[model samples]
Target: MLILTLVIVQLPQILRQVQEWRYPRCYAAEVEGWAAAYDLDPLLIYSFIHTESSFDPEAESSVGARGLMQMTEETFYWIKSKIAPDEALNFDSLYDPDCSIRFGAYYLKLCLERYGGDIATAAAAYHSGWGTVDALLENGQYTRDGTILAEFPYTQMAHYVQKILERYQCYTELYGS
Candidate 1:
C-alpha cells in the first residue's frame, strides 16, 4: 500500500500548512519590511497577528486595541514618540495595516529586549501586560531565561504562549524559515 503510506506521511504536513494558512498575513509587504527593519522573524509577526486579530484589520478589543496587530492607542502614541519622534499620530491611525505593523513590530522588539530576547516572555507581556510580567519576574515564579520559559506563572498567558508557538511552528513548517 505505497499510496496509503505516502498519504499517512504527507497528511500531517498538509494539515499543518492548511492550519497555518487559516490566518493568512494580510499585509505582507509591511510585515516583511518591519520584520526586516527590526530583525524579527516574519513568521513570528504573522503568528502574533493571527493570535491578536486573526487578520482582521478593523478588529478592536474591548480594551480599545485596534488594527491587524491590535495595537492600543496609548501604545500607538508611545511608538510615535519613541520610534518616530516627529510624526504626528492619532488613535484612528492604528486601523492602517502599514502603520500598525510598523509600530507593533517595534513594540514587540522592545518587549523581547525587555525580557532579554525572550519571545515567550515578550509575548506573555503582550497578552498579559508588561506590568504583570514584571510582577511575575519580581515574585520569582517565572524564569527569565530569554529563550524558553522556565515557568510561566499565569495560566492564560501560558495558553497564549502555547497557541502562538503552535501557529508559529505551523507557519515556519509551511513557509521557509
Candidate 2:
C-alpha cells in the first residue's frame, strides 16, 4: 500500500522529467515541414529554439532579438531578401512563431553553408558573427587547420555551441528519426 501510494505521488514528476529529456516538438507540423524544406536536422532546430527563446513565440532579447529563435531585425531582413524575394516581410512579423522558426532555419542553413558544413564554426558565427568568426579562424584563434575548436577563446560562444550540441545530441538520442 505504501509503495503504491509513493508510486502514485511520484509518477507525474517522473513523467515530466522524461518528457523534458525527450525532444520537444512545440510547433510540430510546421517545424517538421520547415526542417525538411531547409535540409536541417529537426533536433538541431528544436534545440536551437529551446535554447534561444525556450519556445516563447513572444520572446525578445535585451539586444532586440525576438521570437522563438531570437533573431534580430537586421539579420531577418537580410535573410528574407536573400531567400524569399517575393514574400512580403514585415519587421513585426518576426515575433510570430511560424516566421521565426522558418527564418531561423534559413539562417542556420546559411551559416552551415558559409562555414563549409562545420557546425561548430557555423554555431559560433550564429552566436557572434561570420566576419568575427572568420577573422579569428583566419588568424588561427578558433581554428588551426580549419577545424572548429571545441575549446574556443570566446567563452560565451564556446559554451553556447557546446550546450547546443549537447542538447542536440540528447534530442537525437531520446527521439531521432
Candidate 3:
C-alpha cells in the first residue's frame, strides 16, 4: 500500500522526466551559441529542430529539405549567401549540426523579425515560405491584422505551426527558469 501511494505521488514527475528525455537537447552548444548570436529563444529553435527533424542531424524530407532544420537547397543557398558568402560550403554541410543550427537560428530570427515577433506567422513562413505567408496575410479570412495570422490558409502548415508551438511550450516548461 505504501509503495502504491508513493508511485501515485511520483507519477507526474516521472512522466515529465520521460517527456524531457523524448525531447532531448542533442546539440546544446551549437543551439545555444547560434540562438544567442541571433537573439532568438533557444527553446524556440529547439522546437523548430524537433518539429523539422526530431534532432536527427542527417534527416531529409521528400521535398529535398536536409539536416537538422531541414532546409531545401534553395533556402540553404539563400541563407548561405547572407551568412557565409566567402565560404565554399555545399548543400551537404547542412548535415553538420553547427552549421545547421547557425543557419536555422538566423533564418528563424529573420522570420520572427518579418512577422513582428509573431511565432505562429514566423513558423508558417518557416514551414511554407515567407512569400506564401505574406500572400495569406493579405487575405482577410486568414489574418485579422496585417502581421498576425488569424487562421492558417493551409491545413498542413497550420498543423506544423501547432507542433512548433506545442513543443516550444513543452521545452519552456521543462527547462525554463
Candidate 4:
C-alpha cells in the first residue's frame, strides 16, 4: 500500500518530465535570441519547432521543407533577400540551427505583424500561405473581421494550426512565465 501511494504521488512529476522531453527547448540560445529580436514568445517558436520537425535539425518534409523550422527553398530565398541580401547563401543554410531559427523567427514576425498579432491567423498563414490566408480572410467566411480567423478554410491547415496551438499551450503550461 505504501509503495502504491508513493507511485501515485510521483506520477505527476514523471508525466511532466515525459512531456518536457517531448516538447524540448533544443536550441535555447538561438530560439530565445531570435524570438526576442522578433518580439515573439520563445514558447511559440519552440512550439513551431516541435510541430515542424520535432526539434530535428535535419528533418525534411515530403514537400521539401528542410531543417528544424522546415522552410522551403522559396521561403528561404525570400527571407534571405529580405534579411541578408548581400550574403551569398543558399537554401541549404536552412539546415543550420542558427540560420533556421533566425529565419523562422523572422518569418513568424512577418506573419504575426500581417495578422495584427493573431497567433492563429499567423499560424495558418505559416502552414498555408499569406496570399491564401488573405483570400480566406477577405471572403468573410473564415473571419468576421480581417484580423481574427473564425474558421480555417482547409481541414488539413486547420489541424496544423490546431497542433501548433496545442503545442504552444503545452509548452506554456510546462515552461511558461
Candidate 5:
C-alpha cells in the first residue's frame, strides 16, 4: 500500500515528462505517412517531431518555425510552391497535421540527401542550418561521426542534438526500430 501510494504520487511528473518526450497519435500517424512516403524510418521521424514540438500542432518557435515539425516560414513557402501551389497556406496551415508532416518529411529528405544519409549529421544540419554545419566541418569543429566537442559554440544546437538522441531512444523503445 505504501509503495502504491508512492508510485501514484510520482505518476503525474512521470507522465508529464513522457508527454514532453513523445509524439501524440495524430502527429505520429502523419509522421508515419511521411516516413513511408520518403523512405525514412518512422522512429527517426518521430524523434525529430518529438524534439521539435513535442507533438504540439500549435507550437511555434521564436525563429518562426511552426507546428508538429517546426518548419520555418521560408521552407513552408518553398514546399507550398512545389507541392500545393494552388492551395493557400498560412501559419494556420502549419498547424494542420498533413501539411506540417509533408513539409517536414520533404525537408528531412533534402537533408538526408545533403548529408549522404547520415542521420546525425542530417539532424544537426536541420537544427543548426547547413551553413553552420558546413562551417563547423570546414573549421574541423565537427566530425563525420557527428561528434562535436565540449567547446562547441552553439549550446542550443548541442542541446537540440542531445534531445533528439534521447527522444530517439524513447521512440525506439516505444515503437521499435
Candidate 6:
C-alpha cells in the first residue's frame, strides 16, 4: 500500500517531466490556420496532435509515421501537392511543428468531410481506413443509432477511437473548450 501510494503521488511528477522534456512549439497559429482552411474546430486539431504525437516534433512511430502529427510519408506527399503545390516537400520537414500540424489538420478535415463530421465514425475511418468503416456501416454491421457497438470489426481501431475520444476529453478539460 505504501509503494502504491508513492507511485501514485510520483506519477504526476513523472508526467510533468515527460511533458517538459518533449515540449514542441505549439504551432497554434499554423494549427488554427489549417483548421480554418479545413473548417474544423481548432481544439479538435490540438487534441489530435496531443494524442498522436504528444507534442514531440521529432517523434517517429515504428510504422514510419513521422513528426509532431505522426504523418505517413505517403500522406505527406499527397497533401503536399494539394495544399503546398509550389513548396518542395522533404521528409525532414515532417519534424517541423508547423508543417506537420498543418498537414495533420488538413488530413483530419478531409476525414471529417468524408465521414460527414461524425466524430466516432471519422475517428474510426482515420484509424482503420474509410473503406472499412464504410463497408461496416453500409452492410448494417453498425447500428444506425450511432453507438460504437461491439459488432464492429477491427477491435484495434475501435480501441484507438476510444483512446482518441478520451484524450480529447482530457485536452478539453485541461485547455478549456
Compared with the true structure, the alpha-carbon lDDT of candidate 5 equals: 0.77
> In terms of lDDT, which candidate is stronger, 1 or 2?
1
Per residue, candidate 3 scores C-alpha lDDT tens digits across 1-177 of: 999999999999999889989888889999999988999889999999999999999999999999999999999999999999999899999999998898889999999999999999999999999999999989888988888898886889989999999999999989992
- Cα lDDT tens digits for candidate 1, 12-106: 98887776568576689999999999999999999999998888888999999998889888888878998888876688888888888888899
TM-score of 3: 0.95
TM per prediction = 0.84, 0.86, 0.95, 0.95, 0.77, 0.75
Q: What local lDDT does model 4 show for residue 132?
A: 90
Off by over 4 Å in 4: none
- Candidate 3 wrongly placed segments (more than 4 Å): none
Compared with the true structure, all predictions reach lDDT values of 0.84, 0.82, 0.92, 0.92, 0.77, 0.75
Indicate the residue-level lDDT of 157 in model 6. 79
Task: Estimate, for each residue in 1-177, the C-alpha lDDT of model 4 and write its tens digit.
Answer: 999999999999999999989889999999999988888899999999999999889999999999899999999999999999998778888889999999999999999999999899999999998999988988887888877788997898999999999999999999974
Please give the distance, in angstroms, between residue 77's alpha carbon in candidate 2 and its true position after superposition: 0.9
After best superposition, candidate 3 residue 153: deviation in angstroms?
2.1
Error of 3 at 95 (Å): 0.6
Which of candidates 2 and 6 is the stronger one according to TM-score? 2
- Candidate 1 overall lDDT versus native: 0.84
Q: How does model 2 fare in lDDT?
A: 0.82
Which residue runs of candidate 2 sit more than 4 Å off their true CA positions?
1-17, 21-23
